[model samples]
Target: MREEVNMPLNLEEKKELVKEVSDVLLNADTILTADYRGLTANQLTEFRKIARTPGIYIKIVKNNMLKMALKDSEYAVISDKISGPQILATASDNPGEFAKLVKKFIDNNENIELKSLAYKGKELDLSEIKKLATLPTYEEAISMLMSIMQAPVQKLMATMTAVPTKMVRTLDAVKGTKN
Candidate 1:
């Protein structure tokens, strides 16, 4: 029989990890919890690389460690779902963009399972999370709004000038005909 070697984190390291998690959660706009079981090491490495975008961070922690970190957080609501192999994704961006990131990961990896998403102090169910994923990012929404706002003004300006333009062309035609 082979004996297993386990070197658990020392008190200091645990404290550091806990503090880091708490701080990340505190500053995050949204947190997504997912199970990363059955994913290969290579797959995880690739996923991590993809997740290195701005405003996103991922931590895979034991349930106990995560619970300790969540103790004083508005994210305490999700502490109950902390069991099993998990990934804690904290995003500093708007919730929609974070949802897009998580949804992208979920779509690429079959082993990754979406558990729950926390945003605005509320725990969103899976369906709500999916809907959020489909939403446009802050930039996209802003551009869409700008285009919508500009369209009407542009049309009004074009229409206002078109009448004068047509009248000028009509007078030019009449003068040429008389000549």
Candidate 2:
């Protein structure tokens, strides 16, 4: 006969898990809490794809555990935003990029919602996060500026091409005067 098995984690194991999570929280630049309550399994997987491309990672945590972990760190910005069944998506370098990605996904998949964003220790509302997503990335905006600035130089070159004919006309007028 098969016997029932009951296994409980020792104190050391629980402490270790909390420590690992705390380290992750401390190193992250931004932490966004979102509700995945209505997303299907496939939708959640799609969301993961977009998040991971830009070095963003997601974790599902118990509200109380996350609250305890974020109590003393920059994550305190959104510590109160945490709700039951929240998924924490975090980025190590640039939170804007991550927010943009998440916002894009939410835009296309309306069912997927953005609960709150904690950017560089500042809490942001959903509308604010959406604005961040609509703004072009820093590099893209710079390239657009470079193109706009080059237009005047191009026009100046076209105007200078007629210089030779104008100079010849002036020389002809001078010869007539001498005659």
Candidate 3:
């Protein structure tokens, strides 16, 4: 039986990979690192499918290559979290949504463990990441704000109309009693 040899990436390929990852990092609002040691290939594929949103990127690269890509980038702080069969997930915007997705995946898959996450150049632990996951999306936040802003006006309108409504009801009761 012949053993197949594993070819290492050449210098140019390494440079290209670094450049690609750097480009993704440049636009990322949130970066997450997770240990994917025990997940099956199918689980990983399912994760990729779930992460296939427009602004989200997920990749499994060598730690050294990812470190090289993270160098000098805002996400460099996350380099310490990159170790031992890790998966990288980044989002260009709506970091809360990305966090929610990762949180859901982690909840469903026992083998996957979240290591660390960086947002706007700050490193956050798992608990902080969980809090982030519960944040509302942009549209949801806007809707909530609108509701809050509209509440007083709605109450005022209802209050203004209530006096006339009560008056009409009192007159109707008087007419019935008189009959």
Per-model TM-score, in order, reads 0.88, 0.70, 0.90
Candidate with the greatest lDDT versus the true structure: 3
Task: List pairs with backbone clashes in candidate 2.
Answer: none
Name the runs in model 2 displaced over 4 angstroms.
1-17, 94-96, 148-179
Ranking by TM-score: 3, 1, 2
Worst 10 residues of 3 by lDDT: 1-10
Which is better, 1 or 2, measured by lDDT? 1
Model 1, position 171, has a per-residue lDDT of 100
Task: Give Cα-based local distance difference scores for all models.
Answer: 0.84, 0.75, 0.88
Error of 3 at 10 (Å): 2.7
**TM-score, predicted candidate 1 vs. hidden true structure:** 0.88
Off by over 4 Å in 3: 1-7
- Clash totals for all models, in order? 0, 0, 0
lDDT of 1 by residue, 51-150 (tens): 6788888878888999999889888988988889988888877778778767777788888887778886688887787888878888999999999999
Question: Over the stretch 1-179, how does candidate 3's per-residue lDDT look in tens digits?
Answer: 12555777778878888889999999999988889999999999989985687789999888999999998799888888788998999999898888888888888999998887899878887778789888998888999999999999999999999999999999999999999
- The candidate with the higher TM-score, 1 or 3, is 3
